[model samples]
Target: MQKVVLITGGSKGIGKATGQLLSENGFKVYGTSRNPDTISNHPFKLLPLDVTDPNSIARCIDLLKSETSRLDILINNAGAGITGPIEEIPEAEIKKNFETNFFGPVAMIKSVLPLMRENKSGLIINVTSIAGYMGLPFRGVYSASKGALELITEAISMEVKSFGIDVVNFAPGDVATDIAAGRYHSPLKESSAYKATYGKTLELMDTHVDSGKDPMFIANAIYNIITSKSRKVHYKAGEPLQKFSIVLKRLLPDRWYEKMLMNHYKL
Candidate 1:
């Protein structure tokens, strides 16, 4: 039987690329978009899913179970980026970031595990970000949410390894994606004391992204993870620096390491 795969946030970007690549490789691919109708025609399937909605998640998983009998891989790729000074960040937007970036993926993993346990085999990939390693400058809370998801991915990896279910955090640095266009802003960010630096920070966000790696860079990395005999708990996808920055952060003293990051973000 062909391996069955499901990816969230599949309407575009990394999720869509992964779905296409897997489908070409003979996996039965099902991608989820909140607005499936908005997606253009594609070779692989698109399932409507709102990862933040419990009912929506349950419904999608149940539908997958009925159709595929067993799901071989689950890729939690649904995430969002919220930008602003930390203090000025709205409570509701912070919660919204956590809801979409962390909680949604958690729910997906939990809902799919029972079926994976029954099969005694599966791989779960949590698409995190490079910012998760540090409290990112303007995008601090968004970083926090991804950081939480990364830890959750690690914990689940350890807990589920024995069940033949492996979970890995795929932290991709600035990939070229429409996610930039989807960025959310705090209400009072422009009026805050950090206003002078805020514009520059946003410019930096775009700079890194415009120079970022391709979505296929991530798609290929994930493809390799799925096909490997055994996988690491974490894999960074992007330019050499992205994959290595996390290593340097681990190697250097915190003061020095943070200095490097601070310099990069012009903080």
Candidate 2:
């Protein structure tokens, strides 16, 4: 029996690369995009899905159920980034970040759990970020949302482990993607205290992302996770330094860790 896998935000970047790779690995892969019609030259089947909308999520899952009797794996990869100073960012913008990055994946898991539980075996992968561990300087809200996702994945893994459902918090550091294009920027008020600093920080962040590891770095990680027998709760993917720093951050003192980050961003 071929394993059925669904990936959100599969039109581009890590999602696209993962879907393509998973299909090549012989999984019955379905990739979702807000505009499925726009997905071109992809080997995997495209499904229209909007994770922020419950109705859209339900409809897409139902469509999948209609075609396949079971869904073996779910990859919650659909997300966006927001950049700006914490105080200057609007409440609505922060809410939007949580809606897409956190709530969307939560809703996805809830909707699919019954199907997974029925099958007695399944894997759920949530795409979080390294920024989630230690909040980024300017992208505070974005980091917070992914930080929430990291915990969500952890909690769900504990609850579902006995049920034969595997959950992994898949955190990727910098990866080359169109996420910057979709990123939102906080309004820069003329009187904003952090206006100048935010601009420089955001620019440096963009530069780091522009020089990020390839999307294949993440795609290959996902492929390995799905195929492996061992159950790892968290998998970090990216350049070696970025991936290893998760350990370094934990071992370092609070002020020292923060100072390291500040120095990296030239703050």
Candidate 3:
């Protein structure tokens, strides 16, 4: 039987690329967007899904179940980005970011587990970020939210192992996508203490995204993980240096790592 796969935030970017690749490879691929109708002529089917809303999540799964009868793989790629100094960002914005990045994926996983348990096999890949491995200046909230999801994947992987289900985190470095258009950015106030440094770092962040790896790079990574016989709990995809940064963090002293990051951002 062909495996049924659902990818959240599937209208564009990495989600779209993964869906297209998987569909071409012979899987039944369904991707979800908040307003899927807005997009037409997509390669794979698009379902309506808003991860921030439990009702939307439930509805999307119900729709998928109605047609496919089974969901073998789920890609929790739905996420929102936020950038600002920790002190300047509003409490509500932080919570909203969590709703999309952390709580949303948790809800999706919960909704799918019952069916997966019944079938006695399933795979879940939570799309995380290289930024999640460490706190970065001006992007702390985004890092924290993705970091929380990474740890949750670890916990879920163990809990569901007995049920023949697998959960893993796929953390990617910067990728070229339209994510910046939707990112929540705290306004740069000229009088604010962090105005100059925050402004510079913000530009640098955008530069990385614009020049980052192609989305297909991540899609290929996901494809490999799905086809692999035995998978690890964590996998990362991106530039060698970006992947190496994680290793460097483990090796470098606390203050030394901090200094290195500061210099990278030209702080």
TM-score per candidate: 0.96, 0.97, 0.99
Clash list (residue pairs), candidate 2: none
lDDT against true structure, model 1: 0.89
Q: Provide the global lDDT of candidate 2 against the true structure.
A: 0.90
Candidate 1 per-residue lDDT, tens place, 129-221, comes to: 988987878889988999999998989998988998999998999998877789797644445798767777888888888888889878999
Which scores better on TM-score, 1 or 3?
3
Please give the TM-score that candidate 1 achieves against the real structure: 0.96
* Candidate 3 TM-score, C-alpha based: 0.99
Q: Is candidate 2 or candidate 3 better by TM-score?
A: 3
Clashing pairs in 1: none
Model 3, range 1-267, lDDT digits (tens) per residue? 999999999999999999999999999999999898889899999999999998988898889888987889999999989999999999999999999999999999999999999899999999999999999999999999999999999999999999999999999999999888799999999999999999999999999999998999999999999999999999999989999999999999999999999999999
> Per-residue CA lDDT of candidate 2, range 71-181, in tens?
999999999899988777888988988999999999999999999999998999999998888877988898899999999898999999998999999999998887787
The segments of candidate 3 whose C-alpha lies over 4 angstroms from its true place after superposition are none
Better of 2 and 3 by lDDT: 3
Q: How are the candidates ranked when ordered by lDDT, highest leading?
A: 3, 2, 1
**In angstroms, how far off is 157's CA in candidate 2?**
0.7
